[model samples]
Target: MGPTLDSSYEDWVRVAEGVVPPGRHRVGGREEDGAGAVFAVVSPRDGSTLASVADAGEKEVDLAVAAARWAFDSGPWPRLAPAERGRVLLRIADLVEEHRSEIAALISLENGKPIAESYGIELRAVAGTFRWYGQLADKVCDEAPHTDPGALALVTREPAGVVGAVVPWNFPLTLAAWKIAPALAAGCAVVLKPSELTPLSALLLGRLVDEAMEEAGVPGGVLNVVAGDGPTAGRALGLHPDVDVLAFTGSTAVGRHYLRYSADSNLKRVWLELGGKSPNIVLPDAPDLDAAAATAAWGIFFNQGEMCTAPSRLLVHSSVAERVTDAVIQRAEALRVGDPLDPATEMGALAGAARLDAVRGHIDAARAAGARLRTGGAPLDPAPVPGGTYLRPTVFDRVTPDMAVAREEIFGPVLSVLTFDTVEEAVALANDTEYGLAAGLWTGDLSTAHTVSRALRAGTVWVNCYEEGDLTVPFGGYKQSGNGRDKSAHALEKYTELKTTWIQL
Candidate 1:
């Protein structure tokens, strides 16, 4: 059992002040001063100031990058045996688990995710990710090829040096783990820039890392964290010539900027897990309409629809479109949207006022474009959760493929409903999006499931379930959705460079 958290704003402020001290930046295993520019971290839960911390700019970013580079070039991290590194990572994972309750509380207070989800899904995944990569550290091996009698050839993978990771606000700690754990396991030093919107958890993670590394005898400067916005700190890390790799998870627009930065600078490898407007297709042969409707609502409304792989666009066969749409509306309306800390709440506030406004704009645009509003279309009254940025789940029926609401990534609990007459049409509709991170299909026929899954351009295809999988499966996107996979053994490829050695006697 873990310590109980007080969800009141005053109590949260007290906790946050202690967890994230002022002028926080972890460099070389020590708390360092960041650039004098401080940013107020506002809680989307009740629009209150949680705390203020120094924001990293170019100067601070330079310090962080230099620390990471020094750690890689002259420090003991890369020189350590693979098994030793694995042991250190395992220790870090244990520390994360020990602090699970506090982490979940911070996420709920800062990022506006439900406390239950922050614990059950986000924090649990963060610890599991570290454990998974920790176990994989010693398993990575070199290969020897059978060659000519006079020659010997060996292929090996080596760390890519300093890795600059820029993570987003949604599931901040979990996404950071996706990049940081793998990079560390591959023997790379890291300079992580967590999103300014929610830096508390990542800052707390830095503290945990410092303690774990100290306990495990891992050297200082192996991991540095910089908290700031994209323009200054993120760009500095991206363009730093000494930084050998950049791993980013955010919007596609920002992902493209990293590519340009890579081209303009050292041409370091960039791995991106970007935006998605994923489709959820419901066929006439769907196993069960009730189950499908429930899954659809959960898919979009979960995390307040801020997930990159959210099933925002729902496609149904004409025969069952009305039935499925009605059922989905019923499910959405039944969801409890209130204070995130409340255990009974199914959904919570948006990350900020900007997100709430963006969702409302999308709803208005859809209505003007002649789409039928089947359910919620406005922000919830502040009476339930005063000052919180809350919105009721919205469903737009009779939405065309060409509508703005259907085409854009709204990043809210807004569902766009479209109908298809045949399997071919469904496939076409699902493939029409510029983003292809993920897609889902509900069908009883195995052939239809297999055929449609293969036809979809998404990186992940869910046949009967939505957002299903574990750490073993690869997650990424195709086309404009971005490049490079995150999770599973496939993720290790991005953090290392391959080299071939030949010997002739």
Candidate 2:
């Protein structure tokens, strides 16, 4: 059911030797030398250096963009039939499934997610994304508009030239797939920049892409990857004049920067999926209180609360606040924070030391700002998992709407509880923050559920659930959480531009 994280370094070394090439960047369908600046890929689990990877500078980014541009303009990729492109994407999906174990291992080891989650959720999503987009490739068609009897009008969707995709560290492979699969399926060339913190899995994906392209007779220079920090590679890709579109999933701060980059440069199309402080509302209804409590715990504690759509703010009806808070505290305290590689571990380390320090700062700030510490505020001892960046799952009660903990995105295993007396107050409290990414409400009244779901400002709202959805549904955010959708047919629109052609008979 889950992968065993007990695999030795020697075991991973063998796999890495095969999956990751000497140079991480794949340009023009081959591995190429990166910039001389090399950075260590440090593991958050025990703070070990897994490997050193080349950091892509402006020069490397230029090369990648050029390759993508050439692929889009003169290469065979865009010229291929939509059905043929679909077949190639299907082949890529097959290869990803074949190497699922290795990809999952790399993700857990590099990003500090539980091995079980890496295998069960992340890897599976990666494969499924390609398949979904593959199936959709041929389905998209041009429209023949109703026109005058003597005239004909046609509207078509064409691939936007080079697509520059920059994905964050959390859920690296799955998020990358969200951008890459659709871009390629739309017959666009891609130059992907994976976060430096978790480049291993993306680089491994490059191998699969290369193999699949060769097998499917797809041309070289269609897919390129450059691993580096956001400032260099990310900025270069954003500001590059030839790049027709940019897709990014990261912090709101960086998302704004890309918008500025587009304006200052060629005004390329920019799609962003950014930060969130999503709220979870528990109402006094006919549903079981125990189940609501468990769901509340899962909303915040899952993935160590490092999710952009994490339900960090829990709003419970005053009548059941104490009961639900108690249940959530019990569940938080019971979570096991240890080795990510261990199959039994429910929670793992933060991505790195920087993230660990950031989470601790938020915890201290919340306590000082008058939030009551309910359970598990202290960091875990390092004795069991030496050198690992482990933090305790924390829950704070008696939190007010204006408190810093409730307002800001801590992005850790920190949950803040607020009690509301009326539905209007609950909606106000939920929308108090700048984020509108997601929200969850648990209630037995069908009318109340529907009413609150519509009233919430978030892009995605769940009734009696949290973070439940599939590729078929569109996922994105509203307000400061950022712009544009990630999954579904809506995502394809971001990779392609619409054109109209009119003819007189």
Candidate 3:
């Protein structure tokens, strides 16, 4: 008999928790590895063990890389007609749509995000990314200069060979698709290493790709997945000479390590999307203090402030600082921090216990350095649920630009509010961080928006909102936030190489 589908999330949860087995990886047309003599996959929500996965050490990384390289060089995928590739990718996107509920549930379970939000937003965004890249597959154009009269020049774009995509934990499936779709669209094979905290969804994606490609006529070994610790599996992939490109999303310190590895091993293409300490500036001319406060609260606390481009620093004009701070505190305190599986839950746990500790340490340090706490100092007691990495939303007032809490990227639900007297001071404070991933400006004045948009060093600036993005726009960071762009047609450039051909007759 065929497997019966579970309609509701509650039924799915019961099945996923071992009444029915969560699926396994599809490596070369078979369900090869599930939980046989390997690493444990535990739930951050209740700390209960989920499944043990393959250890996937250097040996497995090598095998995955080999499979990817074979697919890139000798397999029919890279050599397939561009329209054919595009169509297959579109089929993959359709498969994503078909499995949307299952995929979203896996994401929420693995990443500790609210289920409704994951299903309602994140999954749709991921599908949009795949569809966008699928459309982009055949649209990439190469141009020739018309400088020489007697000489002919031709240009073409080709895949970057095997790509090592190392994605972070925060937005597991979305970020993975950010790297994978473009690379696949550009005809490059991928060996992806998802963060240990949230590998389940990525593994599920591997399964989906296998089924989709089989239906769409994509060759075997075109994509591979291996989940393990960053230092071991991730570093090895970066340092592997055969891997032509490494696209990483993580912390600054780790990015530097990958850069060193890439440089030392093969001088391979290394693209990183690193840390952020984005500023949300509220000018004195802002009309609605309530709207600004609410938006700013979402800016800092959304996804428990685990976003790479989250606006962690609130640079408020002196005139409205007190009002904004008070309003923001009210909103922060009102956030429903509880089980991510609960439909009423607005904010969920930190990625894990270690992250909860890190959030606490940063809060304690800020306190020791004399920053005033506005709300939420410690983890919620009696606990929101059973075993998730739970922490209440935290807000720190009187934060100076130089303070560690203000300057550093604390990937948590911590907001640092600082007052600025003048527009110039506000601009300075906003650009004070080494990260330039994103910034938000709230002002009634058009002049201020244009001025600050030009002046602020972030790659993405929101005039009245935060975390807003579409597939048509580009996303990347300036300074240490890392290089190269993601999303839009530009993202394909990272995965494909340009070649110039000269002919004279």
Candidate 4:
């Protein structure tokens, strides 16, 4: 079922409230909030209020976990045939696709991305994640290990019960699917804590799950969502002893805190996909300067660079540094910043005002630390829509490796360009940062491509393309970018635990 079209702001508001329904927390198959009072969900695009949800404290967390534990232990979900689960997942995917526009609109309003691109493209990706994992639910398996003749042994895979998924504001729906699809496919109940800045989509997802599960016969209490701040709802999920697994996608600093929090409990499995100061290297002999320049623009500017894989660090070989930087600046200038609902709008605002402040502070610091701002050094005026949190894409030239702009994850449409004389220097500079989420290399030389690809210590490397991959490839990071992989058949492993059984013959 696709999303029903809404004509006005009132209609959109109606859709928003209908998605989650004005409610407390859905605990133990009932509507109620635990401790904290009601809080509002605001739209970043225009500062319009979306929904007010119960803050949901520890009591609610306990109730949600207990319900999930009950569902996993006594409900049909865990015991149901794998094909049955697969069918339900397929149904969810269909419903998601049907409601794509409504879902995308809600996401754009709350998270502040262009509605057309986000809803049209990203939402489809969101739905497909479930469809992709649904087909693989039955394919997950474990093999018997070779053992001594005196012993008979077998290895089995089982779902880690009660997952605590903490998702960030950027790409809320898509990233939420990254955690939800795999865990559900593996037969685990989820208590998702979406970022406070963009909780509408998460709440809507709860409604979608309800509809999908009911149609597919998934029992109640299998999937729950609690909307609140990280310290309260997020901490409760990560630190909950009953939650068997904790999966998160956010910043490196927060990921570390979750790691420490989870360790205090049953040592529940922790899977994190964290930050990146990923490099997009332009080699001296890049095949197509024009194409590479355009891709480089998209790499850092797409979603207004509110992406973990945003290639914020542009390492250009001295030969093409001037040409590439000029082209990138030109493209950044032409981008239209306005209402996200417009199909022609290429760039959306930063996710929220707080994010805008953070980006502004980073740019100011870079300037104070002696970097040259080539263009777009500040936020744009409120567009015709008014109250929108927009920023002109900023670029800095002559950025040194030691500069904070070059080293840190700005998580904005701020590009820092640095120059290097040789291949060795380029590779060294590209790998200088603490992050290893993704890196892009543009080179006409086959040997250079192969060598640089291997040398860069990142999880995913794009040879000539940037951000081009389907759900099949594995994605994660190295060094401080955090551990565990997302997408492909490997993600299921994170949600499932391996058990070894032995019998004396």
Candidate 5:
């Protein structure tokens, strides 16, 4: 019998300590790799040693890549009809929903997210992504451009061969699905490298994909999950000439590295979904101050504020800054930070120990830089549940643009409040960041919303709301936030190439 999705905190704790074996490299049809050293995966919840996971080093990376290459060149996956490919993807979505609770528990165990969030956000998105792309598969039609009467011109989209996808630890399965679903739907093979900190869930996903493909009369090697860190497995995939396209979701620095790797290798098409320092501007005439204030608190504290699209900087109009700031402080202080396995928990641990320390450093630096710490600037006292890497929800008011806390992507439950005198300054401050990933605006006037949204540099602008969108609209960023888009039918463009055919009669 398979290990169940443990219900109680005690049952989950048992699984965390090893009721289920840790994930491994799922290469080709093989589930084990003996080529590289094993790394210990630690649970930030209670500081227990989760398990030792086998690494996917250079040789293992090569093996996975080779499998993907072979699958693309000669396997039945690429050769199948578009509708058939879509059926496989649909099957994957069904399989994901069937095992939702188990996967959610596994993710919370490794990623240190609350179980409710794990189930609601990551798992929910994962299944939806597959379903959306699967439905879009056959709907994508080739184009026949108008030309001279005697001649015809045709444009058709084709799979771009093998893809190398690397996802970060923040939202493991959701981000992985953002890259994986579209590629598979487009008939492209992928070698997915999930962050070492959160590889277990991805490995589990790979197993389900294999099972889905087999049931759909497709080959099993269409996708591979290699568990390794950035330097080895990621770099290998980036520099490999065999990969036709590389899609990554991580830091801007790593995004730059992939571009360099592309230049150094066969000039593979590289698409990145990088870092963000998104702003949430609450104007004096906000449609509802209480609602905006609540969203601000939720935006900065959800998932322990590990979201790439998180509203990290709260820019308030000077007139309402104090009231809004005070309201947010009260909400932040009220958030329950405790055991992730516990149902009452509203917040969870940082991804791991290193992240906890780095967040503390950022908070300390903000203190030295003269930003007023209105609430929480240190680790939770007496340790919530003992040894868990839990930081108190932090808020900094009177923050200037130059402050590191205001400019940097802290990737934690840290919020910086800056006051803006006019709409011009608010727009300027929102557009000031090098990242153009996402931003939030709250205003009562529709014209201001329209004009300011157009003026802001972010790819996604949430008016009167934050972190809200569906798969129908494309999700991506501008400037240093990386290239290409994820979600929607536009995502297929990254994995498929267009070919032009000219005919003369």
Candidate 6:
């Protein structure tokens, strides 16, 4: 009925173990030793250490930045013809597809997403992103506005030089691909710093980049990856004077830090795709109330609810609130939560122990504030392995706009249901959040869909659907959700600088 697994869990597990080694960094196209400090790559499925990776620091960041600078200034990547570069990226895409099973397994272990989702969604996005950007590499056209015959004007674009891409633990490889593919397509060198919690997938991706580059007969050092926590290595990258631009996908707080980092250092262009408390509204006139409720449940519970654009806030029309909320609660409770490696699991563990506790704390705060605990709110046992953390899908009804659960991004499998009586109230409630990444509404009325969608302040609006998008459409947000698009041809703007030349006739 859905996307089937390419292989069994045991088969993927066997492939994951051999994907990459511990304490490795890919710098200047070579595997190099990280300084002595190290951190454990703890699997959220089980607290056991999958590998001990280098606890990257200032030294590692400096080395990676230097390598990227060199590559940008005097390497084959930036000098290659756009088509030639696209060929390399196509090779990378092919390689990714070839090793899809391995990367999927790695992501499931490092990030606690189900193996099926990892294979079907994350890895698929990664390969497709590279392929899309690759095909578009030579397709971008520079512009020159028409002028009088006395003057000749020309406009051109150049790579922005070194880019520092810092990604968080959730959807590690997928987010990395979003930044790397476009930056590379624009001929910009990159230094990637992956979150400490889930660095293995990114590390493996760096190796794959090198693999593709080697086959294309191109020089290395175009892309470098370093693994570490946010403060040490991430800050170093942010403050590095050599980085020409930085692209980050994480929390709004961290996005603010990167802004400050740019201001304090080179004043590099910083493009951020930050947090979201996206709202999914269900109107009384929805074409299919059943589908809307099911999608609402899926949106909040998918990926253990770690998505930036997760529909955490559910706004329903008063006329059908009870029926829709009950349907969603049923779906949430019925979701299969267990080992991430299981092919049949619909939900999986949180990142680790700390994440589990943080989610619990959010639930407790919601309870303290007097929100109704509708269906699921508790943590399941350490399953499949000791120390594994799985939280049951949680739903909070009768939630007020002022409540913590409704206002904050819990980043867990928690949904807050709020109600609206009229179109004006629904519009106000949806646009009330500080983060405007995405929003969805379900209705059958043509005018209502058009008018309401036009009124919503979110970057992407889906009518009668949720989280459905292709690579052609861009994704980003309005106000606090951060700046710039992550997909489509516009993403290249983040990695390139525009230059104008004017000559007298």
TM-scores, one per candidate: 0.97, 0.96, 0.95, 0.95, 0.97, 0.98
Alpha-carbon lDDT, every model: 0.89, 0.88, 0.83, 0.84, 0.90, 0.90
How big is the positional error of residue 32 in model 3, measured in Å on the Cα after superposition? 3.9
Predicted candidate 2 versus true structure: per-residue lDDT over 222-332, tens digit per residue: 889899999888999999999999999999999999999999999999999999999999999937889888988887887888899999999999999989999999999
Query: Model 5 off-target regions past 4 Å?
Result: 1-19
Candidate 3 has an lDDT of 0.83
> Which runs in model 1 stand beyond 4 Å of their true positions?
4-23
Each candidate's root-mean-square deviation in Å? 2.0, 2.2, 2.7, 2.5, 1.9, 1.9
User: In candidate 4, what are the lDDT values of residues 349-462, reduced to their tens digit?
Assistant: 778778889999999999999999999978786563688788898999988999999999999999999999998998899888899999999999999899999999999999
Could you tell me which residue pairs clash in candidate 6?
Answer: none
Error of 3 at 433 (Å): 1.5
Indicate the TM-score of model 5: 0.97
Clashing pairs in 4: 1-98, 2-98, 2-99, 3-98, 3-99, 25-32
lDDT of 5: 0.90
**What lDDT does candidate 2 reach at residue 488?**
97
The lDDT, on a scale of 0 to 1, for candidate 6 is 0.90
Query: Which is the winner by lDDT between candidate 2 and candidate 4?
Result: 2
Instruction: For residues 340-443, write the lDDT of model 6, one tens digit per residue.
Output: 88898999889999988999999999999999999878888546556798899999999999998998888999999999999899999999989999999999
lDDT per residue as tens, model 5, 265-358: 9999999999999999999999899999999999999999998899999999999999999999999999999888765688999998999999
| Residue 71's lDDT in candidate 1 | 89
Model 2: lDDT equals 0.88
Better of 4 and 5 by lDDT: 5
Q: What is the TM-score (0 to 1) of candidate 2?
A: 0.96
Which sections of candidate 6 miss by over 4 Å?
1-6, 16-22, 382-384
Q: Which ten residues in a row are the worst by lDDT in model 6?
A: 1-10
